[model samples]
Target: MEAVLPVEVEIPSMRVLAESKLKEAEWVKQCYEQLNFIDEKRLTALCHGQCYQQRMARTFNKKGRPREFSPGDLVLRKVLHIAPDSRGKFAYKYDGPFIIQEVFDGEAIILNDMDGNDDALPVNADALKKYYP
Candidate 1:
């Protein structure tokens, strides 16, 4: 009813500023792409180095002894427990010197105690280590 100040604000200047900022951002992005682009020699070297390291690591497994077990072989089973009240850091990393009762296709094995009771569950071969006295 009463005009104290100008009610209509100039909007075209704000739109023009926003469009100029968007164009500037696009130009900056193109400049960054040109500056930071990797050439063919560097790209090929990076990829070849990664692949060679992986292949070397895989082939280096021949240096370590592989885990294989038969029936009647003594082994130590890894016990993964998450007890909050444990005192030391090395509290019960492995449980027992369980005997391998049976081996199934190199995937899993049945374990038993010294008394020949099948009280433990079947464990994967990766979880068993040779129990050397």
Candidate 2:
């Protein structure tokens, strides 16, 4: 029996198909994100018509965040303070009056308002200090 050569598939169409699939993805996922969460009760209710209440997790007081912010919330940026001997060439210390660009459940804040330009500095909820009203 003679061995048959594998069939060559078109690559361009594959790329187009992949792009279409990406565009079809949910809006919440199109943007860069690592993880996402939703109300388990709501999901359960939708699936089984049951109501649920929120409860504190093990790290509630430690890691639990209970705040929210808008796109224009002013926040202070805190970075690691670098002592030449401790951090290296640059001092890794808290810097800035960077205004929060976007807030993710107040658990994370994106800052960049420096000289009127967005800088793409995202920080953990604990790292940023918001200006008190």
Candidate 3:
């Protein structure tokens, strides 16, 4: 069997080479401009997101009243989840006439039972409401 040799490719002229180089430079410039445009778009999106978050926070905070509790205050602890063995909808929502033993920063509090036994962990102030006699 005889093997066929590949044909030689023609070299481009100087004029063609110069034209191709100009096109390449133009393409590079276009790519750089696109990159800059994308960066500007990303920065604008980030700023808009931050502004949206600030607006939402401001609106929410305007409607909210801060809960403040001090030591020796009687409060009721909200029951989170009902036991499976107990009554479902009929179960009591609030648990305690617990006394506020200690108050911490950020609305965290320690509670004491009626017998004066301190709770093991601190609870959020939102979970407790003032109990009146």
Q: For every model shown, what is its TM-score relative to the native structure?
A: 0.51, 0.40, 0.74
Query: How does residue 103 of candidate 1 score in lDDT?
Result: 92
**Against the unseen true structure, what C-alpha lDDT does each candidate score?**
0.74, 0.58, 0.83
* Candidate with maximal TM-score: 3
Q: Write the per-residue lDDT of candidate 3 for residues 28-68, one digit (tens) a residue.
A: 67557767788888999999999999999999999999878
lDDT of 2 by residue, 31-121 (tens): 3232232365457667653222223334456686666667877777776555546655456456777777777764767777667787655
TM-score, ranked from best to worst: 3, 1, 2
Clash-forming residue pairs, model 2:
80-92, 81-92, 81-93, 82-92, 112-119
RMSD of 3: 11.8
lDDT of 3: 0.83
What's model 1's TM-score? 0.51
* TM-score attained by model 2: 0.40
Candidate 1 vs candidate 2, lDDT winner? 1
How far residue 41's Cα lies from its native spot in candidate 1, in Å, is 15
Error of 3 at 1 (Å): 51
Off by over 4 Å in 1: 1-57
